[model samples]
Target: MNPPYFSENSGCKSPDQSALIARHEVACNLTDISKCAAYLLKHSGRFCLCHRPERLCDIFEALRKYKLEPKRLRPVVQKDYQEPWLMLIEATKGGKPGLKIERQLIIKNQNNTYTDEFRSLYREFATF
Candidate 1:
């Protein structure tokens, strides 16, 4: 609605529960996001999201709490030798549980070079 009207607030804006809930954890957290997704998605509907790699447990915990079963997961790394900085996941609302974790996706090489696969993946957005 109205292009979402992105605004300014620290998620701690006074007298604005909606913005607070949306921007900060003042009234919301991963659980709230999962609940909102649960409300918006139909049974068996698929929901996917990308998040920081360190929050895997939080994401999984919240999704399960909302009856959303994680189906697939992929780690996003900048180099083959480094830890993942991002993670991608797909879940099904009210579906049976069976988490399928894919192999780590190495975005770059040891020398900070973009791998062919990574370049292909982001070809449209890459500059060189």
Candidate 2:
């Protein structure tokens, strides 16, 4: 359920139509996504999505507004970057309020190779 990470008004528009639609809220915004998720998920079902770190607050607020309680968060960082650029989140429908923050998921090591964790995450696609 990864919705567009950028607000329609925030970023520079891309020349490519597909990229523009995929990257920005031209079609649907976070609140729209949250509401749809709530409607589709059964009680206690989990909804997972990845979004930018800067919008974490907004993400949480939107989720909660639709009665989806944030249950887990994992920050994704690249090696050598001090700040996290992405956030992976999981929320539960009609869940109790408690957020478990997991350790950072590093995408690359200092040697510029993918981290073991990252490799394992996409191992199924390696044969391609």
Candidate 3:
């Protein structure tokens, strides 16, 4: 699904909207590293729109030979998952890993139960 932050369609003129979108999509779809490298040359700034700072450095290094600035876009720190506990962790890595460990245990248990139920269902269906 197209992210809500990006426009549903590329309609902006100054940004070369349609071309940018098409190039970005092509870059994202590319599987081969060589193809990705080629796509990056033509559409290097597209990642900036998504506010991916980590990717910016890589893009910069790639475009460096060409003397390209590769615009510095502001990082979009997603507020959707923001919580007091996450804030605490960000403040200190030494904080208890209780929540993360508990979540992992719950997920593992649920997955085990799901696998067992699926196996039982499969066996029952096979007899029928």
Candidate 3 local lDDT, 14-113, one digit each (tens): 3576666553533342123223434554533222223123333443344343433333322222232222111101111122222221111011122234
Model 2: weakest 10-residue lDDT segment is 119-128
lDDT of all predictions, in order shown? 0.77, 0.92, 0.31
Q: What are the per-model numbers of colliding residue pairs?
A: 0, 0, 0
Off by over 4 Å in 3: 1-51, 80-128
lDDT of 2 by residue, 1-128 (tens): 77888999997989999999999999999999999999999999999999999899989999999999999999989874768988999999999999999999998999989988899998998841
Candidate 1, residues 11-125, lDDT tens digits: the string is 2365767755454455556776789899999999988887767567878898999999999999988878788877888989998989999999998787788888888988998
Cα-lDDT of candidate 2: 0.92
The window of 10 residues in a row where model 1 has the poorest summed lDDT is 1-10
Ranking by TM-score: 2, 1, 3
Q: Could you say which candidate leads in lDDT? A: 2
How many steric clashes does model 3 contain?
A: 0
Better of 2 and 3 by lDDT: 2
Query: How do the candidates rank by lDDT, highest first?
Result: 2, 1, 3
What TM-score does candidate 2 get on C-alpha atoms?
A: 0.93
